[model samples]
Target: MKRLLKLYLNTFDGLSREVWWLALITLINRAGTMVIPFLSLYLTEDLEFSPSTVGSIMAAFGLGSVVGSWLGGKLTDKIGYYKIMVFSLFVSGLLFVLLQYLKTVLSLSIGIFVLMLVADMFRPAMFVALSAYSKPENKTRSVTLIRLAINLGFSAGPAIGGLIIAGLGYNGLFWVDGITCILATLLLIQLLNPKKSKVLDEVKVEEPYSAYKDKAFIIFLFALFLFGVMFLQYFSTMPIYYRDSHFLTEPEIGLLLGANGFFIFLLEMPLIKWLENTRFNKVILIWFGALLTSLSLLILNFTTWSGILIIGMFLMTVGEMIAFPFANAFALQQAKKGNQGEYMALYSIAFSFAHIFGHKAGLESVSVYGFDNTWYIFTAVGVLCMFLLLILKQFLKAKNIIS
Candidate 1:
């Protein structure tokens, strides 16, 4: 037991204090993330919108995310990451409250779009900050540490959100989520001041458009988009499948979703550390992760048993543990000096675009063809993404971007 504990502790030993602070900030922000997980349920069950309409509204959120990520990257170069994060946190929190009051379909859709635009600006900026705060050797581990914090908080959020919805209803979920965002903003103000940190001083500003011109990077971005579309179905379609088909309660769904976070929290850091020591090829890890993610969804076609759902979630979480942090580290390494924000923004857009395409497509497929067909289609998508990642690997090798 002591030896195992020491090994886990070693995974976190080399990271600087700033990375821990960033993780704390992420933890606080994500702990209040009650809205997104339950948004489909809120729209469908509470607001009486159809599944298709919920998907459309969620797509609007994605559109805003693309805009926010682009603008955040551009702005981070000029103003730095600190101010952008603060603005995003406080304003987005305020908007979450406003979202509760929106009644009409058009109004709610617009509210979601605007809310995500302000809210998602923080993502790329946070990644840039994480890259700046970490050593090159420690980049992937640092990102994973931050993800660990996120999952820790996520493990709590939905479980608590379930209780909130059960006792006080959906309005309570919005209020608590908004309050947490504002509190996270306050914590950020107290903990981080760019003027005091030399990390910001080291960043040399560069042309914002430079990342777009790198052909290899653009291909990488496409691969990320494909991987993202497959992964995001967990958020977009899986909840509906649980609620509508499995007849689980809100709390039960919350616990099931929370299980993903709990498993990641317990296992991801140690798993990555072990992989690193084995001198594993990062690209191969990504390919394997994507394949596992596909298999997770594909399993659902064969069984609707709750045990199967647990097993699927575990596989998906394992895939996430392998793919996402390495992907971020790869992007950080590819970034030219002074263009971390731009590179990270492009990376963030992969997930944002996934939200736009994945939710709309998955929900629409469920509406038209049913959930079984949608799972089969995404299983194929996951296979295709593995090939794309292989192509990306070769492109990076030919360009001598990575060994």
Candidate 2:
């Protein structure tokens, strides 16, 4: 037991105190993440919106995310990450409270868009902060620590959210989510002093559009966009599929989703530590991870059994664990000093783009072609993204862009 404990501690050895505080803030924020996972279900079942309408509303949230990420990146470079993060958290919390009162489709759609706009602006800022806090050699593990906190909080949130939905209902979810965001903001103010945080001292006055010029990075971002599209199905269409196709209740769906978080919490840090010590190529590892994501979705075509759903989610979580943190680390490596915010912001946009298209694709396909075909489509896209990543690796190697 002592040996195992020592090994676990060794995996997290070099990360700074600020990184741990960032992880704590992430855990607190995500622990109340009751909204996005259930937003589609709420629009469909509770409000009686059509699937298409739900998709549009969800896409609206993505639209806001797109704007938020771009704006956040620019702002982080100009004003620094501290102010941007604190502002995003407090305002987004108030927006969540406002979301509870919205009823009609137009109102809810507009509200959701605005809420996500404010909420998602924090993403790039947070990434910039993470990079600032971490030493170069420990960057990947630093990011993974934050992810571990996120997954741990996710494990708690959905299970508790299930109970909240069961008792106090969806309104209860909004309240809890809103309150937590406010609390996270307060913690940030108290714990993260600008003078104490280890931000990069060098500043370069590059144009906002500078990151767009790197062709290899552009290809990488596109591949990430595709991966994001497929991966996001877990939050978007997957819940609806479970509810409508399998006839599972909210609590059951929560448990299934929660299981993904539980697995990541247990495995991600150790897995990254192992990978760091190995001779395996980062590109190849990411490709395998992408392939696994497709396999996770393809498994759904074979069976809709409850046991199978859990298994599929587990595979998806594994893929996420392998791919995402490495992807972030790779992006950080590719970035020039003083441009981390711009690079990270561009990467964040890939997910926002996924939000824009993934929900539309999943919801529309289900509305038109049916669920099985939607899964098939997702599987095909994931495979295609793997090829893109492979090509990106070769390009980077040929150009000596990565060591």
Q: Write the per-residue lDDT of candidate 1 for residues 268-375, one digit (tens) a residue.
A: 999888877776667778888998999999999787686888889989999999999888887877774437778888898888888778867888899999989999
Worst 10 contiguous positions by lDDT, candidate 1: 200-209
> Clashing pairs in model 2?
none
In each prediction, how many residue pairs overlap at the backbone (N, C-alpha, C within less than 3 A)? 0, 0
Cα-based lDDT for every prediction: 0.85, 0.84
What is the Cα-based TM-score of model 2? 0.87
Model 2, range 299-343, lDDT digits (tens) per residue? 988965767787888899999999998888887766654366778
Leading candidate by TM-score? 1
Q: How many clashes does the backbone of model 2 have?
A: 0
Report model 1's TM-score to 2 decimal places: 0.88
Model 1: CA > 4 A from native: 43-55, 165-169, 198-209, 239-256, 299-311, 366-373
